[model samples]
Target: MARPRRIVLLRHGESVGNVDDTVYEREPDHALALTAKGRSQAEDAGRALRAVFDGERISAYVSPYRRTHQTFQSLGLDPAKVRVREEPRLREQDWGNWQDRDDVRRQKAYRDAYGHFFYRFAQGESGADVYDRVGAFLESLWRSFEDPHHPPNVLIVTHGLTMRLFCMRWFHWTVAEFESLSNPDNAEWRTLLLGPDGRYSLDRPFDRWCEPESYGVTG
Candidate 1:
């Protein structure tokens, strides 16, 4: 195949941080484990994906985080039919280091006030930073397409922010559009289906935290 027929972007399931941000103080963000409900959610998403795929071969790229790895494993795709790689570029936006829950909350408020796209964490990356890397990763993805035997279906197991940024870059969305869309639910995945003309289209629109038309006007 040249370009994949479908690109599946998935957010990792609920992790310790999802239920309790305080875990960051003691546990590294990359090491956070998924909760029981998260496992169930991933399993359910897996079943749904398998049904859509009907046992087709997949080329999978997963984030390096523990939770993402766990999510990919829970997807239950047949290993013999899937070629998977641990993609560091798909990792969650760096938060600098271990965090204090209260401080993180305060920073998040600041981020929202300042604007989500450009707002940088105290010692971490802004949304645009993640976009750059995801764009770079796309180059690699396209390069793989040069091989005639490349799988027709692509799967990405990653964090919410990265997943969103991947789409923004791929679809050439503006900063305002990026800010308007909310993150996907844990274990949720979006399908980007290839059109007859070779362009990709998302199966559904994302829920917005803010109105899309509000951006890019000056007084």
Candidate 2:
């Protein structure tokens, strides 16, 4: 019999800094808080996920970022059922010098960094760093599967870049492939299946959105 494992990648809702676009890494990281719109988004995301596995057993993991944490709360999950494990590996790619740039400038910088995610920050992290951290976290999660009681669905709430990397790694995506898979919206869930022997297979393609017209399709 194949041991079953499904890891669900969830990106956190919008944040105030995300909207204003002035938030480069804050001194104490106060900029990471969720904005009103983000809160609403989180609530919707939570309810949507809850409905998917309404009565099914599930476990959750979260990045330490405030936005990601708040997103999890909005979902209405029972506290006991949701385990708040802080996986730094799941943190967003450090924008470094570009953290506090205005919207236009930020967009340019972001585009430049789009595919070369492995690029490092002056005092922060790169896409490669995020991938390494998530890799470690996934290893730990795999260990948890050793216990027969491990839940069937494990939800992970994290940042946009990190979530992208998670999807890329699980899909065995190359550099070009990773760039093609990036997107900003939440509400859409990326699913992956892990067999008992420890190899992963794609149960569903990366883009399973009910409404794909909103975001143009990517190969």
Candidate 3:
């Protein structure tokens, strides 16, 4: 096969940040840990992933963020059969330093007014910036495909936004297409299965989200 037999992108389990915006006021986003339920979610997700792998070895690229690292550990995959690497490119979209909740909310409104792809977060990155790094990460991934020792299955444990950008880069989706897609649920994963033709197809395409304010409907 020209590429791995499968490429699975797994969003990290729910973190403290998911339930409490105040966590960002105290802890760095990169350092947040998963919630108790999130640990359970990762365990279930791991079982589901094993079913998908069906005895094949796993080659995993995990984001360096604490939550993702914890998620990867919780998966319970055989450490002996899985090769793991910490990939910073797989980290969450940075909102920058300790967050002020109200300010973050205001920025999101501005982001909505602009476009998802182009809206640069203050002291952080625009989606385009993330896209560039994800693209670079893909180049390295392709290079890894050339090695005979590369495992047959690949898993990426990362953030939801990073996962979407990954599919955008790999599938060559347009900005509109990207914008229309919703993120995978926390601890949920989307798979890319390799067919006989050496191409990849999503096990299920991402769900679509409506732009409620679009189409100029006046209230």
Candidate 4:
């Protein structure tokens, strides 16, 4: 085995912070929990997964954020069948001190004006930083694929931006291509299947479409 036969990237369902962006102003990002509807969405996602997997064992790598863990729990996958691991590298981008600031709108505007991929927030990580970590994770994934004991199916539960960056890194998409991708909806998922060439290919187009914007920034 040189590549996982199947890979599923899932975004966590709506969290308290998603319902009220201002919650991050007071609560730590990692502490944000899921909403009631988010739980339902997670269960729905689990049912969809069960339909696809059909009793096949899966290895899951979940972000350390509370909401992601809660989403995984809500998926209702059998603990005896699915192997779960907490992956810090899959955690949400570190907003650092920016989380407590009230200027998120302005910061987002600045990022949009400049470049989301390279703009580093004040004392925070950039999209490129996240890409680097995800690249490392991909390398580890390839190694896992070569292991005899590795599971055939893999699941990764992570944040929206992280999921986008993971695809960019995995597929070697250009910055323009990366920027043109919108975040997947809460609890949404995408699949990749290993091809005959021993490489993974997207099973389908993203659920959402994004248009390319001219952000007056080069490289």
Best candidate (score: TM-score): 1
> How good is model 4 by TM-score?
0.92
Candidate 2 lDDT, 1-219, residue by residue in tens: 323366778888877766765555443352477878888988887787777766567777887878888888887887765556767767766655445456546555765655456655555666777788777876777688777877777888887677777766656566556655546585445666777767776655554323322233443
All candidates: TM-score: 0.96, 0.78, 0.94, 0.92
Tell me how candidate 3 scores on lDDT: 0.90
- Cα deviation of 39, candidate 3, in Å: 0.4
How does each model score on lDDT?
0.91, 0.68, 0.90, 0.86
Clashes of each: 0, 2, 0, 0
Instruction: Superpose all Cα atoms of candidate 3 onto the true structure and report the RMSD in Å to 1 decimal.
Output: 4.0
Q: What is the model-wide C-alpha lDDT for candidate 4? A: 0.86
lDDT of 1 by residue, 83-146 (tens): 9999999999988798988999999999988887899998999988998999999999999999
- Clash pairs for candidate 2: 24-99, 46-75
TM-score of 1: 0.96
Candidate 3 contains a number of clashing pairs equal to 0
For every candidate, C-alpha RMSD to the true structure in Å? 2.1, 5.7, 4.0, 2.8
Best by lDDT: 1
